[model samples]
Target: MPLPLYLLALAVFAMGTSEFMLAGLLPDIASDFGVTVGTAGVLTSAFAIGMIVGAPLVAALARDWPMRPTLLAFVVVFAVAHAAGALTTSFPILFATRVVAALANAGFLAVALTAAAGLVSPGNKGRALAVLLSGTTVATIAGVPGGAVLGTALGWRATFWAVAVLCLPAALGILKGIPAGRGGDEATGKPALRAELAQLARPRLILVMLLGALVNAATFGSLTFLAPVVTDTAGLDELWISVVLVLFGAGSFVGVTAAGRLSDRSSGPVIAVGGPLLLIGWPALAVLAHEPVALFILVFVQGALSFALGSTLITRVLYQAAGAPTMAGSYATAALNVGAAAGPVVGAATLGTEAGVLGPLWASGLLVAVALLIALPLHAVITASRNTEVQR
Candidate 1:
């Protein structure tokens, strides 16, 4: 991987920490703002909404704009937003900052994907992306937990300040390490925004993205409710929740690391294999939700399989939309976020209907099953598109 990819990953780490660490601080935020915890949770949804809307929009608007400056500007804005969030007194003001920060995070991510891909040779695009995504995985393991600890020790404001401080190093890294010029400047060719949009509209790309979304829906759905599973279902102590989260994160790190190496050659094959594993794994997890040892082990195993499959799908989407250069990465970001936003909703509904922790598992199973039904035939379609791209 190139230095720019690492720098982009660094930026992603800072942004990702803010994106997730808020979950642990919701109680503090709610208390400080005199709002319900559920209301404070809306900030997470705001971030997701921002990412979903801003990713493609920003990428399209900046399709031909210089990437380096745009990326730097996003980091600066993000840092400023965090700093404001840390210092603000008004809850509405804090809400506004989260939205602003999310917009910048989405824009930076979309552009960084393009820039990261551009930094590597065509064959190693998947590996480059994996390197970049590793930052997020590592953040899941380290940064989210770190934020929780910081908030516990020094209050939620300290967590915001810490995340704000992280952006400085990321901004410096991007300015120094990432190259000048548009994200498409180094690609085989840069298509106009219209052409890119047309390419993205293709059935092949849509199916690939939808499949990715469904996979993510399952992954995130189950994960969003895993705390209850660890406690009520597995009958474990509350302390084990953090351990379970870390184990899952560790598994994700391993999976994404392996996906980077394997995706270029066998993304389709990996999907074929891992896809079925996950589809079955979810239901099995629901059934095993009662056994602590099995629940723990399967959580780790499922995490590895889910991320391995998710990363492979992302690589495939990038490959399928590579013709769009600057626009390609947005498809993956938007699709995954759509799933991310939807997953918890589905899980929450099941719980509301008296499904308990097992509701999330059932939600995951149903999602993966639907994804499998769609992907079963599209496997050949994805291969055909990739072959077509290579032939071009």
Candidate 2:
């Protein structure tokens, strides 16, 4: 990997920490603001909402700007939001800060993925994204848990302050390390927004987008509810919850690392293998819920495989949308936020019934199965496209 890949990793680390810290700090934030933990949880949802909306919106608006400045500007915006979050005492003000922070968070990542892809040779783009996204995986492994512990010890405000502190070095690294002329400004061709939109209107791109949505819904739909269900229904302690969460995070780290290598070689097998694995694992994860040891193993495996699907899928989208790869990247990133935002809502509604904790996981499994059905068509589309390209 290049030095720029490493520098972008730092920015990803900072952004990932800033974006995900709230999930572990919800209780502390609620206590600090005299609100319910439920309300504090909305902060996570708020951030996801901002990402879903801000990604395409910002990409459309700033498609013409020089890439480095735009990426750096978003990082600055994110840093300021964290600082503001640390300082605010009122709920409304803090919530506002979170929304602003999330917009910056979303935009920064969308731009970074595009920028990172631009930095590398064409054949190595998948590795580049995986490396940049490794920060997100690492954040899940270290940052969130550490932030939770820090929130318990130093207060939630202090955690945000810590994240804000890291952003300074990230900005400096980008400024000094990343080469010029590799940003959106130079890469962006004539205004192809309408043309790209027309292209996406084709059945193939729509299938890709739909597959992105279904895959996201399948995994996050269950994951968002995992902690609550495992603890509340299974009568597991917080220690076990932390352990399970760590296991999931660890599995994800391994999966993300492997995804780059796998996609670099054969993206089709990754998707074909991953989708059905989730179909199997989700059901098994729910069935083994009563067996703690077995469930732990299943959760780890499921987390690892579930995440690998989307990253693998992204390479296919990039290949298909060769003329406007950044738009494909933008859509994939936005799908992430959209899935996260939808997960809790879907899980909460499903869990409201008598089906209880297992209900959501089962529902998620069904969604994955549906995604598998979608992936079949996607695989055909990719195969046909490849064959066509070869013949030409």
Candidate 3:
């Protein structure tokens, strides 16, 4: 990978931290604003909603813009939004800031993926994406936990202030590392909205998007309620919660690294193996949740498989939407956010049932099964299409 790619990764790390750190800080935020925890939880949904709406819109508007400047602009705005969020006392203002920050974060990631892919050869596209995505994995491991610690020590506002400060290096890295005129073919003219939409409307592309969504839904559905399950079912102490989360994050890092390398050769085998692994892992997790040792092992395994599936799904989308790579990345972001947003709803609904704490794991398994069914046929269709093209 190039130096510039790592710069993009740094930006991704900062953005991802901002996106996820709120989960740990919600209680503090709610209390500060004189609201319930449930109301504060809406902040997470607001961020996802912003990503869903902003990604495609920003990608379309900036389709012809040079990648470096566009990325820089987004990071700067993201930093500013964090600062505003940190300073705001009113709940409504903080909510608005979250949405604005998410929009910037979405744009930054969409352009950064395109920029990273452009810096590498076609054969290394998967690896490039993996390296970029590792930032998010790292954020999960270090940034989220660190933010929680900071929020605990100095209040939630301090965490946001720290995030705003962290963005400086990422913005500086973007300005210095990314070269001018990289990404997109402005000389060829900006793609018409209809052309971009046509590319997105392909059957194979839609399937790929669905695959992305399902993978996220399955992973997050169970993960969203993991703490309760671990405590209620596994009989683990509250102190072990952070340890379990760390284990999951570590597994995600390893998974992304392996998936990146393997996906460079072909994504099909990775997905073929990973999908079934997820299918098995989730159900096993449900049954094993009461066993502390087994629960720990299963959580790690599930996290690894989920992230591995995500990497391949992105690679598959990039391959399927070759004509509109930037838009493809944006759409992929939107699809994943859609899943992230939906997963909690599904998990919460399942939790309300008699199935109790283990319901989320079982629900996640069913979602994975549906995804695998869709994936098997979609892979066959994509393979057949490629074979036909090769024969010509």
Candidate 4:
């Protein structure tokens, strides 16, 4: 609702493009460094791992710090990481930059989530989050494709340089837009690290975060290796990579838009329906990998289902951990990045085997199924409890 919310989204767009653009750059990166594609994928996992570790750590450190300057500092670090990455000569140097970039991304997202939910009333958190995430979905449509083209024409380093430039405006936006002090969620007292850790032991909260991690694992696991799936399994030209990615982004926009509206009202039901459909969709995508048209249609379908599922799961996690508003954001972010980290590992492992490019799809299907098995009954109980409350 506030100008800062939009600015946060703008910053997220630049970070997200850095994250997703790797899909298109993987082949080129691998070739440049004389490594296997699977090896190059370690960059994805490394980034996720950085986020997984950094989210909570950074959030805890910055809990009492002024939110605006903290956010701006992270953006500066992110931009510098990209500049270093663009100038990197070896894979190891580039890999270190990815880790640094991801750490900054994790810190920014943790603070932004807290700031976003704090901007609106209790009921609008979902929509607020959706607005924040819109930057990421929009990145798929425009930023990612643009990065791919840049990577294709001028070299992957150019895309990194462009990302660095993009971060400049985002940093300015943070400086201009964000308030001068800590937000509502960043309580004014001394840090309560113990209370935040206590939130981790709650059974329901743990389950919700697990669901978040699992769904994202499936979503990102498949996404991390999408280029190979497009070029190899689908038998499409290299040119089609951006097209399919755009389609996926378009579907994701629609999905997150709908989920933002529905989640506040019917999180349980929406999560219930979306999870199973995604579990089915992942396997279906694999089966039809050989068909170009099926590839196009299914990716969109997968994107919609995956993001809708992801958004709702995260919104639910936020609510579940809201008791510790001080650290809820860091925990939610860590949970999601846990999945982001693991997903690529699965994709990379499968790629190493006979599954090749198709391996990621199967891994995604398995991840979703596990996530659904855990989530379905929980939502069923939630739905019934809500119905009881209404009847009473």
User: Could you tell me which 10 consecutive residues in candidate 1 have the lowest summed lDDT?
Assistant: 181-190
> Which lDDT tens digits does candidate 1 get at residues 1-392?
66778888999999888876764566678888998654665676677777889899998887766778999999999989999999999988998898899889889989888778878888898899899888888877788767766786788899999998999999888789877765446444666778878887677788878888888878877776675677678887655666776767778888889889988887877888998998888999899878988887888888888889998888888988877888888888887777776776677677756676588789899999999898887677765545686454
| TM-score for all models, in order of appearance | 0.90, 0.88, 0.89, 0.95
Question: Candidate order by lDDT, highest to lowest?
Answer: 4, 1, 3, 2
Give the higher-TM-score candidate: 1 or 4: 4
lDDT (tens digit, per residue) of candidate 3 on 56-119 = 8998888778777899899889989999998988999998998999899888877777667777
Q: Name the runs in model 1 displaced over 4 angstroms.
A: 23-42, 87-95, 182-189, 235-239, 390-392
Q: Clashing residue pairs, candidate 2?
A: 67-184
Clashing pairs in 1: none
Tens-place lDDT per residue, model 2, 71-170, is 7898899889889988888899887887898888877777777777777777776788789878887876777667767776788888998898889999
The predictions' CA RMSDs to the true structure, in order, are: 2.6, 2.9, 2.8, 2.6
Ranking by TM-score: 4, 1, 3, 2
- Per-residue error for 163 in candidate 4, Å, reads 0.8
What is the RMSD, in Å, between candidate 4 and the native fold over all Cα? 2.6
Q: Lowest lDDT 10-mer window, candidate 4? A: 383-392
The candidate that wins on lDDT is: 4
